[model samples]
Target: MSNSLTVGVVQQPAWPDKARSLAASEAGIRAAVSQGAQLVLLQELHATHYFCQYEDPALFDLAEPLDGPTGQRLAELAKELNIVLVGSLFEKRAAGLYHNTAVVYDRAKGRVGQYRKMHIPDDPAFYEKFYFTPGDADDERGQGFTPIDTSVGRLGVLVCWDQWYPEAARLMALSGAELLLYPTAIGWDPNDDDAEKARQKDAWTIIQRSHGVANGLPVLVANRVGFEPDHSGVGGGIAFWGGSFVCGPQGEMLAHAGEETQQLVVNIDMARSENTRRIWPYLRDRRIDAYGDLTRRYRD
Candidate 1:
């Protein structure tokens, strides 16, 4: 594999209409390709609005099977552009079974692999637990946290809420993942004060960057932008602060985007992960024998 990898992120606002939302994603993908990005990532649920803000049974209709229209389009785009692409979807696995899933496509190989969002969030405005069944512990081919193999590299794909967990990132790194990628849609309540909003955004950024520093791998995050109103009227709408970014092996920012629809393209030095790990060998010095309590629900 090449020592350098050019990656891109599409931070775009979504719409209720799938066609319009997909158009925006396609435009961003094309722009990224024009800039010579070999791999591209789209924000979570780029096909529709943040409907998880409120739970309604009728909204289940939004879910589609694994080979749904959205997935097919993403595969076609990967083939057309000859680039590795990552996209998110609402997957309808079976009757009343659904998940927040991320799919990967590699050039002409079509759909290569996928990862289901493991950590489902149920906060006030984010009610993912109601709409999604937590991903199974093991996919047919491998374990839940297994990295997906692609032409670009081994991508440790995780979804929105999964980004917050250190164990998830560590497991991916342990499984020999070359990079960590997050398809996220996290935002703040518009009513929050400026200070609170800043804190929330900063915390989100820091934790994800820390994942890179801890694992000695590059990190790529694609977050949605714009204000999405809570049509259910249960609370104020979420203003998605689209600070999508890419960071290198040592937690250095390569490229970042503000709160707007933007495409970020950056070159990641793939060899840096190996070099950094040589100097700061966190993985080599891990106390694997004494960490049996990690599987417990609580120490108490």
Candidate 2:
């Protein structure tokens, strides 16, 4: 593992057309590589628009197998650029099952590992529960919440909704993850007022930054931008607030992008995690024995 790592986060708008969406993603990847980024991350569901805005059986057609064309394209990009890449996909695990999955590709190594989104949200506009099945808790290799080992570093990659959970970050850190990453597709309802939008965006940003401060690891977030209208017309469309960013171990902003199609290339000092943890020591003071109630759905 190197003492420093150069990373990239691509935040772009998406369309229902897969070809057009991927072209945008590829352009961002190329731009990042030109700036010496060794690892790159694309936002969640970059291959298509936010289809989960409404539940329709037809949307299942949007999903592909793990080694399908989208995955292959991402793997090829990783090899072509000689960089480790993280990309999100809507996976068709089986006939009646699907998942929001994140895939990792190492240069020349092909598809290395994957993490299925564990938290499925069911809200008015973001109806993810109708589409995705949560990841298994314990697989043969202990997959859930496990960090993926890569040439760049051990990556603790989680999807959008997972970012709101501290347990997920803590588990990844406990398993030797060096950095935390979120490939997210979160936005606000267009009908919301400006004050409400600000509150929502601020809360989202603060929660993720707090994850970095608590875990003593860098956090990388890539979120889509632009307004994506709900085709079903059941609700007002979402205006994706594209405030993609990179923060250091101390929750200090390294780089931040505005609400536009942008790619951020930032150098992360890997040594900071060790130095920060040594002084903060949040991990060492954990009262694990007294936290057994966390497993229950509710304590009442």
Candidate 3:
């Protein structure tokens, strides 16, 4: 594997229309490729507005098979651009079955692999548990921490909430992932206090950076920006704080987006991971034999 790779993260406001969203994403990918980005990542569920704000059976129509139109389009895009593309989608596996999945396409190898989000959060405005089935033993065979082999290297791709779990990062590293990529859609309740919002965003960034340092690999996060209305006509909606960023193996920020509006194309040296791991030796020093409690729900 080479030491360096140029990556691009798209941060833009989403609209309720799917057609417009696809067009915008396509344009963004083209622009990134033109700028020499070998790998491009998009926000979570980028094909439509954040739809989990409310639980309605009608919204289930939005889900489609992984090999459906959206996947086909992205596959074509990867081929046309000749670049690896990472995209997240609301997948329709079967009738009344769905999942929040991320697909990775290696331009050279074609549709390389995929990962279904393991953690399903069910917060007030975020009703994801209603739409997605938690990824378990069934999905892990074809979709798990197993990295996607690409011309660039093995890619450790995880969805939004999965970023908070150290186990997920560790598994990916053990599976030979050269870098960690997160496709996220996170923000604040519009009614949240300014101080709370600042704290929340900081905590989010810090946790992911910690993953980079702990696993001895670079971390790339792509998040959506702008505000989307609550379909339930709730008092307020989500204001996506677009602080997408790329961090080095040692948790140093290589590039960051602004809270309001920002898009970045950053170059990362994949070789730094080896050097950082040599110095920190977190992985080499881990006592895997003493972590039996991790399997139990609680140690009590």
Candidate 4:
């Protein structure tokens, strides 16, 4: 078998209406599949605006059951297109419990695995903590990082805030993930100056790229684009810097979408990761025995 995979990302602006948003994603996926993409990823919470800007309880209405309408529609699409699909959504685990979860569907297996976001941010105009409950029932907090096995590849999937943490990526790599995937909804504060905005966006991209380099695995990010006004009047709404991209194992960007609403399809050479790891061998030189302090909250 050829050790290569074609992946696609749908970087779309959110619509208030769920049906409309689904349709937009559908169109993007279809376009990418037409281009021979075997696996596709949609941005974080593609069915709605970055609603965490306002923390009203009313927004909980957006949360849906794991097998709800969104999953049903995605399953149909995956089977029809013969593609593996990964999508992030507001998961209504129960009446009083909720999570920001990423659901994965194999073309032949339907719903395979789901990763509940481990990190929840509570920044200005990004009140994610008010909404999301962290994953991983094993710990006091944090859903343990584990890669999902898929027909396309083993995916080390993480959500937006989780992408910033190197530990998360390392754990996924150590767990046998072939690639790292992040479903992100990141952007700049309109109040920040141009330089600050540029810095923030650059840092985000660099951090994700480092994961691919450090782990010797390909990386994919699907981010939302366009700006949405803050209805709650916290401050100027976020202008989502939609630089969705894919990178090779050596931290080289294979392809990227600009700061606009567009669907991206990129061909990835999986064989390159094995060759790069053979030469770099970072994992082989690991000092795994001496890293006891990594488990601590902080060393005093």
Candidate 5:
């Protein structure tokens, strides 16, 4: 059997309306499946606009059960396309309990698993704390760093703010993940200069790529694009820099996207990770016995 998988990332702007956004995403998923993608990824909160820009109790209405309309729609799509799909959603775990969750669906397995975003951001424009509670260490199924085993491969799925933490990536790698997938909703402030935006984008790209290099696994990020204003009319809003991308195990970028609407599909070798890990040996060289400080909040 060929040890390669063709993956696709959907990078599109979200609409205020849920139905419209789902329709657009369905079209994008079909586009990718048509082009021979076995596994597809969608941007974070793909069902609606990036609403974390402001604190609003009304926005909580956007949350839904995993098997809700959005989940059912995606499941139907994956079953129809006969492909593995990784997507994100605003999860309504229970009444008054919400989470930023990444859900994975397989063609044969229905709903494989989900990863609640461990790190929730609460910056100026990104008011996530007011909206989302921090993710538990384990999912409802009681698993952390558990890669979903599918027809495509083992996917180490994660979410936006979780992308910045290397520990999360490493744990996934240690759990036998072949690829790291991050459904992201990241952007820049409208007031920031062009230089700052560029720098932020570059940092976002590099740090994740370094995860691939450090763990000997491929990394994929699907980010939303376009400008979304604060619905409460409190902040200037965010311009989500849609630069979705994929990279190889050796930190070599296989595909990259610009700051616009795009549907990126890239083919990658799944077997290369084993070869690279054998040569680099970072996993073997880990001094697991000496690193006890990582569990602490800070060294100081």
Candidate 6:
């Protein structure tokens, strides 16, 4: 595999309509491809605004099957652009069973792999647990940190909340993922103080960056920007801090997007992970035999 690949992260506002949102995303993906992005990653729930703000049964209708229209559309796009595409969607498996899933389309081989969001968060505005079922424990369908093999490399792709857990990152690395990619939709409550917002966003970015350093791989986080309204139609809802960035193996920022704008492309040398790991060698010195405590829910 080549050590360098150009990737693009699309950070744009979502429209209320699904068709319009899909069109906008397609346009963004095409534009990224035009700029020479071999792999394109979109923000979480890119086809719609963060609709988990409420627990209405009506919202469940938004969920579509993996082979449904949405996925098919993206597959067509992948074939058209001849670029690998990573997309997140609200998937409807069966009646009353839904999941927050990410699909990776390999341009060379077509639809190849997918990973469901494992860690569901039930925060005030982000009521994900009520909607998505946690991924099944069995690895039959390539769940968990099993990286998807593509033309570029094995991609350790995970959703927003999963990025917070070190176990997820470790498992992906153990499975031989060359890079970690997070398709995220995170932000701060409008009512929070600016200082608090800054702290929260900074902490979020730093945690993911640390994942790169700890596992000796690059980390890419694609977050949504702009504000969406709350369920109660109140004032401004979560203002998605759009600091989508790419961090090198040593936790150095390779590329970053602004807080309130749409960034098209960010290029990086994928081979940097190998050189950084050769110098730092954290993976070479792991004490695996002493990590039994990690399996326990809590060490009393």
lDDT of each: 0.94, 0.96, 0.87, 0.90, 0.89, 0.86
lDDT per residue as tens, model 2, 1-300 = 999899999999999999999999999999999999999999999999999999899999999999999999999999999999999999999999999999999999999999999999999899999999999986875469999999999999999999999999999999999999999999998888999999999999999999999999999999999999999988898999999999999999999999999999999999999999999999999999899999999989
* Candidate 1 worst ten-residue window by lDDT: 134-143
Q: Which residue pairs in candidate 3 collide?
A: 3-270
Question: How well is each residue in 1-300 modelled by candidate 3, as lDDT tens digits?
Answer: 667799988777777788788887888788778888999998899899999888889998888888888888999999888899998878998898899999988885667888889888999888999999976543546666677778788899899989999999999999899989999999999888999999999999999999999999999999988899897896378999989999999999999999754457889988899998989998778888999889999988
Which candidate, 5 or 6, has the higher lDDT? 5
Per-residue lDDT of 108 in model 2: 97
lDDT of 1 by residue, 1-300 (tens): 799899999999999998999999999999999999999999999999999999899999988987899999999999999999999989999998999999999999998888888899898989988999887788677649999999989999999888889999999999999999999998999889999999999999999999999999999999999999998888899999999999998999999999999999999889999999999999989999999999999998
Segments in model 4 whose C-alpha atoms lie over 4 Å from true places: 137-143
C-alpha positional error of residue 240 in candidate 3 after TM-score superposition, expressed in Å: 0.4
lDDT of 5: 0.89
Best by lDDT: 2
Query: Which candidate model has the greater TM-score, 4 or 6?
Result: 4
lDDT of 4 by residue, 102-133 (tens): 99999968988889999899988889999999
Clashes of 5: 0
Runs off by more than 4 Å, candidate 1: none
- Model 4 CA RMSD to the hidden true structure, in angstroms: 2.0
- Model 2 deviation from the true structure expressed as Cα RMSD, one decimal place: 0.7
Candidate 4, residue 217: the lDDT equals 93
Candidate 5 per-residue C-alpha lDDT over 154-257 given as tens digits, one digit per residue, 9 for 90 to 100: 88998888899999999999988889999999899989999998899999999999999999999999999898988888888888999899999988999998
- The better-scoring model by TM-score among 4 and 5 is 5
On the 0 to 100 scale, the lDDT of residue 259 in model 6 is 78
RMSD of 6: 1.4
In angstroms, the error of model 5 at 229 is 1.2
